[model samples]
Target: MNDYLVKAVAYQNQIRAYAVNSTATVAEAQRRHAAKPTATDALGRSMTAGVILGAMLKGEEKVSVKINGGGPLGTIMVDSNAKGEVRGYVSHPQTEMEINEVGKAVGMNGLLTVSKDVGLMHPFVGQIPLISGEIGEDYTSYLSKSEQTASAVGVDVLVNSDSTVKAAGGFIIQLMPGADEEVLNIIKDRMKVIAPLSSMISEGSTPEQLLEHVLGSENVTVLESMPVRFQCQCSVDRITNAIISLGSEEIQDMIETDGHAEANCHFCNEFYYFDTEHLQALKEVAL
Candidate 1:
């Protein structure tokens, strides 16, 4: 099934929740970054969480999720927007580790911080101790502690030892205005019983299905569904603009030695080549 996300109101609008089926999108990231099993699972969970958060914004507003795990996986950077576009990269995608007791990747020993920069609004920032070095708990901690919104977030990523994406997906549930005690209890109970996110997504369940299970079929109303993908907004022209920022010295060096410059974008791994003529053209343009 195509990767997609859904926004919903559950328990008669007492709660606001979002869920997503991001297997294909996460798989694309795993392949592009060549992430190992543990790294793949870690990065996939981050991307899934990022995608759902992105769906909560308005036009031109975006959220950037950064996890400086300080692990072999290094840092994970995700830039997502309201349009269901998500672009992310791991500082070290090739890292891996043996499965732990839960059959999940081990070695998270790191903190988590997510900074959401929405255009001109001073950029909302949230930080929390990395509860599990797993993406979801960190996000849950971030929301409950930093954002002051009681929330439950579950993210699951399954990766094969061969560096292949087995399954990946997640959901975020937030208590809305006037959320009652009973609603919270119902949500907690459902969250406790929900299946591993990967198992559901891998079985071809949509975001709606996941939410239905979490909120109970009778108490949920699906609002909107949008396609989500691994998207990057980097181009040769953007790279050229960045090169111009380097000033004349760097430009001259490239023109003199390599005759051209090549930059590999971290998000999409797309390389932008700046030939001598292109550099010269950029040099003449006014800042």
Candidate 2:
């Protein structure tokens, strides 16, 4: 199924929940980046979290999660917006490790740091140390410390030995201000039978379906639903601007020595080539 997410409120507007099944979405990243099992798991969870958080924003506003885990995977970056668009990449996509006791990839290290930068009246940045290299723990840490809210986040990704994603997705639940004791107790009770989140997503279930299972169908209300996918905003023009930014000297060097320069986007790895003539033209503009 195509990857999509849903946003809604439950428990009579006492809880905010987000759910998404990103099997195909994460699969695309795995295929494109050729990520190893552990890297695939990390990237998949971060992107899933990016989509859920992206749903919380409004038009032209978005959030970015940068995880510098200082592992073999290096940095994992995710970009997402309220419109349900998100893109991400890991610095090194090919790194393998053993699965943990709960079938979660233990990754290169247990250390991670997830940070969020929001564009508000004044841009704000918040960060938290990851409790588990498993992204959900890191995100949960971010919300509790940075946003100062009680949140439960679960992200799951199952990869076959061949490195294809078997399932990928996650859920985020936030307790609103003045949440009562009954609500907390209800959530704890429901957590008992929810199963691994990605498994439900892989079974061709929708985000709404997952939430209905978690919060009881009677109390669920869909506020909005959107079709989201693995999207990248990079383009040839952006690469061109980057090339131009290198100043005239660099452009001249490429024109004289290499005949042309090929630029690869870090996000998509799509190659952009500037032939010698194009380089000379850009240099003239720089002059």
Candidate 2 per-residue lDDT over residues 156-231, each given as its tens digit: 8888879999998878888878776578568757877788887787677688888887888998888877877888
Stretches of model 1 off by over 4 angstroms after superposition: 100-110
Which candidate number maximizes lDDT? Answer: 1
lDDT of 1 at 227: 94
List per-prediction Cα lDDT, in the order shown. 0.80, 0.78
Per-prediction CA RMSD (Å) = 2.3, 2.6
lDDT of 1 at 75: 81
Off by over 4 Å in 2: 100-122
Q: Residue 142's C-alpha lDDT in candidate 1?
A: 85
lDDT for each residue of candidate 1 in 116-145, tens digit (9 for 90 to 100): 667775987777667667678788888889
Q: Once model 2 is optimally superposed onto the true structure by TM-score, how far is the C-alpha of residue 135 displaced, in angstroms?
A: 1.1
